[model samples]
Target: MDLDSLTLAYAYGCRNAGDFAINEGSLALLDRTVPDVDVTAVSRFASESPEYERMVEELDGVEDGALVGGPITYDPESQSRPAQLAALARNGLQYGVDVAGVADDLSVHSALYEGITDADAMLFNGGNAIHYSPSHGNLPYLLAMLYPLQVARRNDVPYGLLPQTTFALEGVARRLVVPLLEDAEFVMTRDAITFDYLSEFGLSTQLINGVDTAFLNGTPTAGDPSDGESNRIAAVPRFSTLGDTGELDAAGKRMEDTFLTYLDRLVDAGDEVTLTIQTEIDAAWAERNRDRLDDIGVGYYESYDPDELRAHYAEMDLLVTMRLHAAIFALSVGTPTIGVYRPEWGPKMDGTFRTLDIAEYAIPWDGATVETLEAATADALDEGRALSQHVADNVSLRNEALVSDLRTALSTADGFA
Candidate 1:
């Protein structure tokens, strides 16, 4: 049997530049590690859409397959009953009549239908969207995300959730997600915390310890050392939201204020600082925070290109970031990073730091202060070289584990040829 001839549908919607980096890095890893398998991606929106075209173009090695509109309706009241029923019928035919029809909107269902029906197996990429988070108010969106996995199972196609962070499932969410996971060929979590959380549900057979796929990215070469006069620092910040309101609550406000104080302290210490923006939300936060910084000379960078982004990280002495991929990008490129953990955002950030053996560098958002940030930043800069070496060694081992498990899963699928 020629496994190289098989087709895989890499299904997940790219949300921002960081996501594009992960998708690109995952493809690069698969090409190097597995090789010769025809791959296609299923996105939630059109690759050419104005909002995501750059992110799609930035994905280096992935080929676009289908644009399934997202699971949740932007305007629920606008959908008609007849149109919904028709979509339900189409979804039934594509996934299987037995899988419960959740997404009754035709646009997304059709795209998912085409992507799943045309592929031999599916790989749900790394992200925290698969599970429910109290911070996010999108139960329908989570259900819509899991329905495709159900589709794969009903059709008896091999499918796996790649290295991702999952939260503790509860209530109806547990009921919907557990069965699909039970039948999955493999389920790898990026951290022991999530693995242990899933273990409590007794899905132990499918669960595996896996590292984030971003570690498979090539390491950044050492660049010119910083002048003794000033150290360059990259900081990424995100807006906090609770419930569905566009307002920041007390906790969210405190976290944002702490981040600003941390950045101000960096500027006060005579360091050259830049705000690294990887998503639209980050851009908005940067713009709003810029006024608060006054003329402190903080630069802003938003790059969809991974190489360009890595170069930005390489020139920095240290990264203090709230975004998971921002830290992943820095560490992958041999730049030291201090992760700002948002417990509200689920376990991905801290889990990833733990996986990389740098949990000490992660500061919790609730009680964070400028002094804590300053100390962590100093430690990271002083031990940058040693930490970089540690990251490189661990990344190699994790990449090998990811590839070995993936290859075994693909080879053992019932109809691979």
Candidate 2:
């Protein structure tokens, strides 16, 4: 059966520009793989934000007039209900609870309800929101993202998970979600570590090792800075290194100190530096470290739109980021990048850099030093032009492979036709 006969619901919801980049690329991938395929974009928010609308318009491959809405509606005060219901349904199914009843009780948005119920299949796009990170212990938020999958099961519609970096699904989170994952038409991981992590579950579903969809995005044209003579550098901060308690532990302090030292040296070298806050959490961290940044004389840059972020990144001469997406955005725009990330944050940074044949640029937080950052930055700057070409070539190669594999998975799925 051809994909043209299928109507797929693409479920995603995140305010992150990095995730938006992934969604944009995922839409592009789907367009290339199934030119005439029908899709409904289901978000978590009850109403589409202005940024979301802008993203849909800016994306080149998303079909025009595609429906966008959320399936579940809840206020911030009681958003946990859907997750609780999902968990209840998961455990109840083993004891013979009706899937249809559970699904009916959970859905709120009419458009998403109709989209999921009528669609032949469903696909989840964007980055790793499934895992339980210590820094982010909002289980409701994570489980709520899986509500559409539960709805798809109730409707007997097959669903596939696109490539993403998901991990740390332990205890209750694993118990609640494993069945849903096992029931997927297929599951794909963008990193090998996650592929192996999921393999431990011994799922019978088709598990494919696919590349991140972000690579599918075209390289953005570099924009000129207001001061054309300035050597501009940017960095993205993430607070995950603060450890399981989500506070500034020794390791987190060390990571911050090392970064501060790097920034000081950059200032000494006459490079204009700024920190990019990609999400609300990053902003919180920046606020907490206001004194630190103020002392270094570095300011924070904020942008919610992925396209806008890419344009800003294009103006940078170099980027030293703790966030993987920030590095990806910078590299996508031909800005040299170095990733100094926490070691336990899984293999995303390493996997991405290795894929680009620039593994040396990804340094573990524990192993990172001012020296290492400086050296990597110097190397990245020296190789900036070559890295851009390399990124383009790899993006082309990986995107082709991803599309080819996705087609295989879709054609073999239980639905379509």
Candidate 3:
């Protein structure tokens, strides 16, 4: 074998969209070349994240000889909790987990990032910002990233990054991770916006302009336009803990008012709906906008398993999404997704909009109102096949090109460093 081990450090909520994106992408790229190598599944997704622990406990009950399905399994049971466990059982590889059931003494979280520095080759994918961007506050995420990167460097392992977005860099980013990204053997980003951002910061990198890594996700969209006219509008609810809600409220009011007016104009137009987590982080805004989804009785979905979640995007004709993976999934499955962005910080979606030449889909923070979202959405749903075709044409090239690029990249990694 030309290469023996290519390790990865995974960050994000366990089984969340971002985590799923990173994990699946890493696997896809690796399978392109080194099929016989060991793939490590990290036990701790985030510091407080319990995916590792939860899966550990769940493993205790597995009677052995179990099968897990990928997200897109056509099975009805695959869309439920049973599917979650089954998927884990089937697809997950045993890594560092010290949860009570395992006889090993090593703590799961500690073991996840423990040995990467000693590996001959390594990769980091879809990590969340621990470095505390302007929007997110100080946390342990950066520390987690730093410890592993430093270890990899000390061992002189060939290191690479897979489509990560960095922010909240006042301290952690500048001191901890960016330098590693700059000096790593190779660095790649999903869209031009991020590629440019890092380049300005002095990183020697390539712009592969990929979807959110999750675009290749196996989950099939319902792809049914049964509610085409009714699924026209969407609302990205805000739940900022750092910024002023006054701004968010004012913005939300303007957009909702605009959407309602548009709703009145088109007798056949559908309504805009909200999606967000119910917990404290962004709950207030999600709760408020949820009423919009409720009042109109529009089709709505809340936080769901990353695997099971693609159905929502598939169900939509158009999406006004703040979540990057949501839009990635929307575009990949041929549903056009409009990325709602904030200033100076949202390269993930903004870049995708530009790279895909779907600039009309980039809805800026100050510029997009619920009304504008509704108007655009109504048109998309009204012209369902046309919109789907547009997304299909743009994204398929990017997705196909990326798969080829990764294969070429993996083949090249044979002698890298």
Candidate 4:
């Protein structure tokens, strides 16, 4: 039962909030299910700046893992980047970096299949697909950058994708990833467009729509639901992409203007309007949004520990978000969530908003005119409370099932080697 005997690897955009949610979710799941295993986390993408330094530091002590760099840069012409990733992968495998915490019994583990078992239950944890932004190339080390996933597959190791978005493969890139998806144990995207695109490409994947990992346990507001005084909706301003140079401050200003306009139209609309901040790597962005708020809001879970964060989500009456994890946290409390889908990277919208029963709640990223957003918001506010209750009753059970599937995937009895 030594907590430091198991090992694992993850892929993430540490800059994004979803990465934080995924890590914390895995940790919670681990602590509850896995009796005694040391978890190792390695950050894939990083820079030499102080902010980057803070990020890596924040992820401290979570995993007994190593963080290695990749040489394969995303731009197809950046030959050095890919080569570096390949070298890192080879070096890591050669050095047995992934086997750092397998206790004495499973120390020699290195195969794909051979699922483990403890007592009568199978240990369902193994090499997992780092669910993240396909738009962000630096972290993943590019398409087909490493064959470990393939290796894990060959060994019969189960691969579970933690709430990932999608990218439409075109030309040679598309040609390469099809077979990879074909072999994945399970692939769940964050939006419908991604689900549809991957399906169009012939990957018959399940479409179990859910919010970001961050939403696993967000809080709710307590302004007295009995009085109907706090019947309001919440939203995060839209900003940033995995590979964009857009100024978040400017985006914040635009959100402020848009929010005010959105509110003016709802002067007597029964729902109070408010704003919250969801950050990826941009602290400045969250701060900018906070500055623009009406001196009071919920869903601002920054700089808070997981317990406090969960409490914050419990306080919300209704939640709407541009950030994926924000949706998850709200959903964790059975709060109705609206997921925004921008059009430029239409594929990124794959799983988040492509969900059935909630299609009317989705705001098309490219088509978010105030009128449409307001109209949708108005309708959602009317239906939201009941929707939240329904999710708390129905959807929460489905969420538990996903966790069960994950547990089955991570059974830890025998050797994965």
TM-score of each prediction: 0.84, 0.80, 0.72, 0.64
**Local distance difference test, per candidate?**
0.67, 0.70, 0.53, 0.47
lDDT of 3 by residue, 244-306 (tens): 223445555565565444434433443444353312333455456556545555444555354
Per-residue lDDT of model 1, residues 93-130, tens digit only: 64343254445444434455445656766777776656
Across 259-287, the per-residue lDDT of candidate 4 in tens digits comes to 55665554345555545544544456656
- Candidate 2 residue spans exceeding 4 A from truth: 4-14, 48-65, 72-99, 102-111, 133-138, 220-231, 240-247, 287-295
Error of 2 at 408 (Å): 2.6
Ranking the candidates on lDDT from highest down gives 2, 1, 3, 4
- TM-score of model number 2: 0.80
Q: Pairing residues by index, what is the TM-score of model 3?
A: 0.72
> Which 10-residue span in candidate 1 carries the lowest summed lDDT?
66-75
Looking at model 4, residue 46 earns an lDDT score of 29
The collision pairs in model 2 are none
Candidate 1 pairs with clashing backbones: none
Ten residues in sequence with the least summed lDDT for candidate 4? 112-121
